[model samples]
Target chain A: MTEPPFRRVVVIGAGLMGTSVALALRRFGVEVLLEDADPGNLRVAVSLGAGVPVTPGDAPRAEQADLVVVGVPPAALGTVIADALARFPSAVVTDLGSVKAAALADTRAHAPAGAGLDRYVGGHPMAGSEQSGPLAARADLFDGRAWAVTPHADSRPDAVAAVERLARTCGALPVQLSPGEHDEAVALVSHLPQVASTVVAGLLTTAAEGHLVLAGQGLRDVTRIAGGDPDLWTQILSANAEPVARLLHEAADNLHRVAHTLEKRDAAEAGLADLRNSLERGATGVRRLPGKHGAQPEAFSAVPVLLPDQPGELARLFADVGAAGVNIEDVRIDHSPNTPAGLVELWVHQDTVPALLEALAHHGWDVHG
Target chain B: MTEPPFRRVVVIGAGLMGTSVALALRRFGVEVLLEDADPGNLRVAVSLGAGVPVTPGDAPRAEQADLVVVGVPPAALGTVIADALARFPSAVVTDLGSVKAAALADTRAHAPAGAGLDRYVGGHPMAGSEQSGPLAARADLFDGRAWAVTPHADSRPDAVAAVERLARTCGALPVQLSPGEHDEAVALVSHLPQVASTVVAGLLTTAAEGHLVLAGQGLRDVTRIAGGDPDLWTQILSANAEPVARLLHEAADNLHRVAHTLEKRDAAEAGLADLRNSLERGATGVRRLPGKHGAQPEAFSAVPVLLPDQPGELARLFADVGAAGVNIEDVRIDHSPNTPAGLVELWVHQDTVPALLEALAHHGWDVHG
Candidate 1:
């Protein structure tokens, strides 16, 4: 069947998401109008071809607009959406905020008494980088990513459908989720992860910072998320404090158990086992994520092969695995620092592990048990 | 200056390290003789060009071996080193165990009940992956990496020099450290990292395991070290429990504080600033890691740029940056799970950030504020 339609679209904010929505909509043959209070942002959007910039001076043109996408900051979101609704009463409205519950509550607060309310559909495109501003916007920015929509009780079926169509046009799969459920999920996946990474990174500055000089890939991986932008993350964590606080509290309780185990016992086996089990469960939770570009199915196995640490050993192993007619879903190598002569670990697909072992062993490779 | 002669090198315990040392020594035109309890391992070593594997049946050309390298498990290190000394008189011996402090202490227990113990030097190569067995042996595993030699007060200067020369011949830099100091440093840099990763991975597996599906790059990073061989790590953590425990306790304390700060805080500017500062410090700490290939100079500059999530965006960005004559030292990207959009943080020379920023800005890119 032919595509439905991508008609006149208005993206308020002209910041990262707004500009992205406008640029993405352009690919679908929709005429996009990007608006922002910041003059520089509007100019940047125009330069990036997100759309010709729009302002209150040209607000009259939205009379024929079919869709309105909100991408303003969480605090200022209500006023912007209300203004958009007041100007274009018939346009279907949705938001692209991280916190859906608070945004919905704010949107509810701004609706006029029984007027221009049915056109509003509370929505959040669960997408964005820490870096913001109009210049950071990109076409196809949400391709194959999730867009969670949480409609209000009073929202019309037509409004929700129109918003769904808009989301589809922007290359995101529309997933219906309750605002509260969405917040809790992100608290675990997004919010808790950022905070955990920060604390781990902080540990490097302890009694002897000199040891951090030898910080290897494992430490780097554990603390990678800690390098995000602080100002915007401040806004996000603040907005979702209630749920994030609950998640962190849960993590702290578990961490306390770990600390007591390590300090009181010698082996700390029981405590460490509990922690290990929990982390395995966490890893299981995360493995359910769709692969990049939404192209592959869920992956679970971690195949490991012993390797010698030589200049071309890694490259050879990968090439060896590739020649085995098996695709490596992903790979991770372990670099242990306590050997007189270095060894390496190659993690691949579990099914591929047997074949990889056979192929490499035939090549005179020294794979271990 | 001509190096002091280390002619007949004896490698005790013909396992992975022993076999690899045999191979490496052969490359240097040194006559090598290896010994292992397992006859099969010695055969494998002989087949792998690790020199003629000598067993107890044929007492190793004892007095001929100028340097005897002990390659045994940490659990048996003391006994192994002492046995080699008792069997071969006048051999400058060194053990290649993970923890030098514990190994030195254990060897001290079985030391010849007399003076002139200056022939033994404690050594460990700060390289290798988490895999054990003779099949994991490599010829050039220590190339370009640092080897820490922890010599006790009783060790002879000539013995230390000989080991340093051996490390150099193996293409490694020799860093001298006391046994206790080396153990503590490794606990922080190596052992603590693995434990932190395992603990973090445990956090992902609570409740019904749908969260595992979402284990994107962030969680992968946090838990990467978890998949390591738990048994080998157990021996290591047990040997260095004091420092690893200390570091983990410090991390747990900080995590608890961060969790507390996120609890039921008011929406005031002051409260927001505290959270922002905490995250900012995390960013700074992560940035303090050593650069690629162990660049002794740590500090590097980064330029943040936004790119469209399309095939050509990466190529376009690289072309633009390269066309400006700027050399990129490294690149780090923020992987956003919910969106195709990501932030690209490029590390370049300190002086190149401004020029790259100017070029990118001139080309209408949005660098995050």
Candidate 2:
């Protein structure tokens, strides 16, 4: 096997991201030392074979570490990162935080004068779950995900390279951006949608039980991310307050425009064109999202098949598709409890539709248009 | 095996909903006559075995129909329903439209004096897809879904029963509500989310391409519904203008409040509590949605297992899962192209988790928490 990216790495927080990083580094045969304020978290990380706990007696080992990954909560990111730099004077420092600018500013504020400020870079792996903590960590969590590596102006080239290497070692593609640019990008892609989803879901609290019972897949998808931990989100939002607030205000303005146009539509039916334009713009925007693994979504065609509700039906269907030598890009099962037949939509490359259709026909699977 | 609900049914406008309804009725040996202003849609529906095309030569069959289902665009619902009542005076007329109050009011205005207005009822099926037209239709589209039956004050009991029966014949649960109440309910559950999603996605048009590369599943889910046809949505929103505008205003106010709180947090950290409260409310509201087929979402647990990226691996996994005798409630596959292993999240009843874990371990599948 190739030599490990880092000779010795010390991870200062044994939470989800930190533990996952340690576990990923261990896969490369790199020596890892883990530490956390909470003994339970440290114990769990160690037991998961992520790394050996950096006990008091392991101080010398930590001092000799070449890289220190600080994976604390947003509120504590800067202070902990600054402390890591002071404790391990020669090691390059990095953090896993959602918001980059705030963390960089805080680190600069907390670091003593003449400290190695050039050693720090900010990284955010664009991957996570609604769940948190050590048990939720996985070595492959970042696979094929974009990891934003944000470097400050004062950051050294070698430190930025080390952070990029760290992202790659975790099975992620590293995209380099300045701290401010990274913050601005996430404000649009991540924070804006998060707040918009929250506001939509927040309105659901007033919905009658009968009304909510009418909710379908659309509402569920739009609000799924709203169920994230409130405490965590509060910290995240607070840390990136300026940019997120700007986007929220802009969104509010658009929503108000729609509402005003709708009210006018009720009065004279004059704003139908405006409503259509807004909806059209939305349609155009949604089509711009990159599909799984960076492919265009339209490049795949869905062939929905009706599967009988019985054991091994899905297995049999998949087996037939596999026999046809067609790769399934995605599968969506519309399972309805009241019916004996479920619709499964198999998405494959547009070119593979003919072969897949033949396979379904040969297997006697009912295919829907 | 049993008598079909309606002896002869006429479906006008062979679009997605109409074609799906005809296909569903055909499953029960019911005779259906399909009609559409567009010859292509009628031909496709007829060729799918949904029904026989109602050409000019089939006037006798159309007149003898016991039920008339108007499945035209929202703008034409009232005129078509009135025309159907005039053409087949004895037939009970119902419509598949998103907004109930507007359709009922328009029909009331268009019907001639003493035109048997009691035979008309408005229906809004709480199921749809982003795709439209006959080709996207499916026989089981409404399986285990709610179908709202809205009866105005003048409707007769038999007519109401006929509409409810229609709902059942299409494999949906019939929900009874007044025209006004159904409008209000859907304004909250459907139209509100649609507009919210549209607004969020509309902003994406202004985002930088690099920023969009940072998008993840959350943005995708929140914007998926925004991809629905703009013309169709314009009509749906226009018809439900009053209720939808009211809810949109409320949502806009809430978004503005959150934005203000976030802005305040940046200055003094004073409104963090307010922000948290909003997020908390959103979390609580999202949890209120009923799971698949009305089951509580919390009743299921997700078991994520890593599968090797190879053809037939999915079939093998499903076969193993079937051998364990646990019914998989849902399956979500996170297939990253760059990875050698993909993660499949199988949702099952919480009580079956231990059994599933045992089966997975025995099969040497790598399970992730």
Candidate 3:
């Protein structure tokens, strides 16, 4: 096995992010020590082979470790980083905090005079699920994901390199940004959407039962993120309050204008124009999003294939497509409740659509254009 | 072959919905006559076997048909239904208008004294795609979907039955509602979500490039409907303006409160509480949505299987799962952009999870919990 970049690493929190980091490092043949305020969490992480838990009688792992990762919640980030810095005088320290600006500020305010501020780098991995805790942790959690690293001007080049190496070793692509820039970016791409989904979905709580029966894919797609953990989101939002508030205020203004224009009979034409502009702008924005394989969004043709609602049917369909040598770009299954059949929409490159349709049809599959 | 309920069906407006309706009816051996202001659309529908086009010299098919279906836009519904009713004096007339109240009123005002208001039933099928036009029409578009029917008290029983029969014949479940109630219901469940998605997604047009790189499934799901045609959505929203405006105003207020609390440093505790309540309410609302098979959401354990991004890997995996005798409840593929591997998350019944895991592992597939 190759020599790991960090000989010994210490993880300060044994939660999902922390445990996953430890597990990833362990997969790279590095020794990892797990520490958590809650003994139960520490035990779980240790049992899962994330790392060896630091016992009370053990030597101070922080002082001996080459690197320490602070993976606690935003509220506790400052104190944890401060304690880790004071304890590990020679080790490089980094944090996996969602909001970097506040954590960096708090760490700067609390760091001891002799403690190396330059040794600290801030990281926010753009990966997570609705689930939490060590049980939800996986070694490959960060595989192929974007890990944003925010370095201060005074930060040591060696410290930044260490963090980047860690990210790369875990198969994550590191993108560098300043703390404020990181906060603003996440506020737009992540925080704003979370809040919008929650607010819109909240309306459904009081919706008439009959109205909900009419709900379709549009509502389902719009509100899927509303199922995120409320407590965790509250902490995240609070840490990034300024940027989030600014965006929310702007959204509110737009919404108010739409409602006002729509309510006025004389403004019908204006209302139509405003609504159309918003939608068109949305179309342009969504189109810019990176498609599969990190390429620009390409226009793909959808060939809908009818499949029996049975185990292995999807496998059979995929096998036939593979036999035809067609690369399926994306797939969406639209299954009606109480139906024995589903329409699996296979999105393929435009050039390959004709061949795919012919191949599937020859294989006795019902392919709908 | 079984005789279709309607011997001859006249479909006006040969667009996506109209063409799909004709196609579905044609599947049951009904003779469908297609009419559209755009001859290009009419020709395309004819080529797709959606229906036969009515030639200029031919006697108007509407006058001889047993049913006259007006599948026009909200703005054109009034004129088309009026003309169809006048031409087909002995046939039942119904319209597939997204908004029923305004169209019903318009038709009522335009109908001649001898024309029967009782023959008209307003309809809006709760099924569609982002793609429109005759080329996007599918025979099974309405299979197992809801078709909302709005009828006035003056509507004749035979007329209501005719509409219901048409919906059933097209493989849609007919749901009866008043014109006013239908508008209110769609405003909450459909129109409001569509507008919210557009406004939220519109913000991305001004977002920095680096920010969009971090966009995830949440942003994708929340903004999917924002890709809809602006002209079509404008008409849908305007026709249901009253209820949509009411809902938008309420959403704006909620957004303002959350922003205010988040902005005030002194209100951190209160802000967290408010945010949590909003998220919790959203959770409650989303929970009430019908799950697969139109039933309450079932708790399914996700079994993440690591698959190589090769042509036949999915098929092979499915074949293995089939051999294991496990029924996959649902599946979501979370593939990282540009990665050569993907994690296909297979949702299965809790009881079958262990068996599925064992079988997959035994079959040499990488299974992750």
Candidate 4:
């Protein structure tokens, strides 16, 4: 009836991910000790009921913990990890850092606990948003997403199992990769896209492209990730610079090739083919993308409607369209600074177009033929 | 009123735009003549009860017509406009072409219908989908988008008015841009981003980078526009090669700059600054995006929940959050691969976060500490 080795856990970061991990551990009836230097975050996490605070001075209670999960900022990763290992010599220690190779590079030598840092595994839950902190955390945040554990040569079998168990408890699928491999993969997926999105967003000059001041759905899509936290992504992209930079240059090369084909007044065959292939690949990539809960979702159909210039016209149109017996799938409105009227486009089920049209026509509307 | 000048309308080219135009004119009690060499599109338009077909051997209905709208492919734009002028010598003739410059250039010589060719004008509606053809035609399509007309120096006042009237009837705002200006604006806003999104999607080799394959909301946003019909976009980009190529080149330049910053290893000041400014711009851009019906949207906040991997978990969480009495303003989900258990993020009205968290915690759920 002895307590199974490592039961209680202490996660050393109270940011969004840390709070989420703490909340998740609570579901499985495990006592989670969530830590952070930020008073605001610690207070938020406590209010959320994720855990009660415990410090280094908590003594045997802290040292006797089976696992210490470090979910601190990437820049503070090494120091925080070293301190945890020293404080809890028998406990397995892990850090959730975006950069694997560098983060885990000093794991063994710095971890003064265990024969080696064998009980110290590395984990990265590839989940995020433009916002951050405990306010952004959730108990079910890690469910069904990739939780990568970049294991080092000196990492202990027990520590790896403990981390994996924690990941499973949080409903994440655990995958293993060497620190280098994980870094390279994320560089392509996460790091490169971040910089690319940023550059795209920055292209709009405050001058004539003052038009950039009024973007549409298309621009947002291409620039969504560009709006992420600068401090966080800086540490990520910088750590994995080699791969991210390589991808950026590769993207530029592709652009150059396409540009030259069109510049030379080539029949557009080569340029079209390049874009065609690229678009198709992107199409497939989008299809492969997971939906709300990580499942592939059906592509939504959008319907464009012409709205009148006067006020209340759009509301009336929507009300009329809704009465036509179809759910509005999505809507897009086009506005022109130079024009007197506006364009209102509605996205409905593909089957509802005719009904919506019939309804508007019945209402004596003057819509597009 | 001289019989309101020309009372009958002729829509040459039975495609979706042409047929939709014909249908909308009926809302105003106008006589419609739908002309098209494509019997299939004509049949669809007729089936939609849009218009009655006009035969080839008929005399110039121009004397009785106020407008003749030509909706033909860009390559054939010049030929169609000239023929419409010849056939409707006394009617104001206009065209629906995606690339205004090419169409204007092609038909520049056939201006001044004065009820003859002097009445000809070049027009383009900022609408259409991957799905094209008369079957996809709907009178509501142009209700709230822009319909640009590039008037030539020789354009008669009556002809321009007629074209502008057509735009208005379609519920579209009439935007008057010089052919060059229209071309450039679209190239920057519409064309460049389409190519970029497709390229990003194309760059994904998720099979190899398994975890990276865990594409989320960001990837979908960036790639949504890439699913456009390649053949159609090909024709569009090529027809407007000069401007599109220029924009693509500009984008390439920006990409290179970002790559260089990353390569310079100045993540702290230079690289990080670049990243942050990009994100800030993106956020600004997103905030500035027009909302439903082109209204300036209020910003909504995302309240992420760490969801369980189980199927019913999301349903349960949502029910609980809803029961907590917070109104949901909007929502989005992101999940990555290699991690079966993932984070479930929810978006809600801004300022409701604290109350919702309190409610969930009050229910004895572990959120965070």
Each prediction's whole-model lDDT (CA) = 0.69, 0.86, 0.82, 0.69
Quickly count the clashes in candidate 4.
61
Give the residue spans of candidate 2 off by over 4 A: A2-8, A22-32, A40-52, A266-270, A292-369, B47-49, B266-269, B292-294, B297-369
TM-score of chain A of each: 0.76, 0.82, 0.80, 0.73
* Model 4 C-alpha lDDT per residue in residues A255-315, reported as the tens digit of each score: 7666666676566466667755666776665555555423422434555555544423554
RMSD of 1: 8.5
Q: What is the interface RMSD of each candidate, in Å?
A: 6.2, 8.2, 8.6, 8.4
Ordered list by DockQ, greatest first: 2, 3, 1, 4
| Residue A224, candidate 1: C-alpha displacement in angstroms | 1.3
Q: TM-scores across all candidates?
A: 0.70, 0.82, 0.78, 0.69
The model with the greater lDDT, 1 or 2, is: 2
In Å, residue A38's CA in model 2 sits off its true spot by 3.5
What would the per-residue lDDT of candidate 4 be over residues B35-109, giving only the tens digit for each residue? 788665665566455667776455555346768888887678887787777666677878888777777767755
Candidate 2, residue A356: CA error in Å?
Answer: 6.7
lDDT of 3 by residue, A139-158 (tens): 88998778898999889999
Residue lDDT tens for model 3, B219-334? 88888888888888878777788899999999988888888878884554766787778878877777777767336345577888876534335556777888899998766654
lDDT of 3 at A117: 90
User: Where does candidate 3 clash, by residue pair?
Assistant: A337-B293, A338-B293
Candidate 3 overall lDDT versus native: 0.82
DockQ of each: 0.24, 0.32, 0.29, 0.19
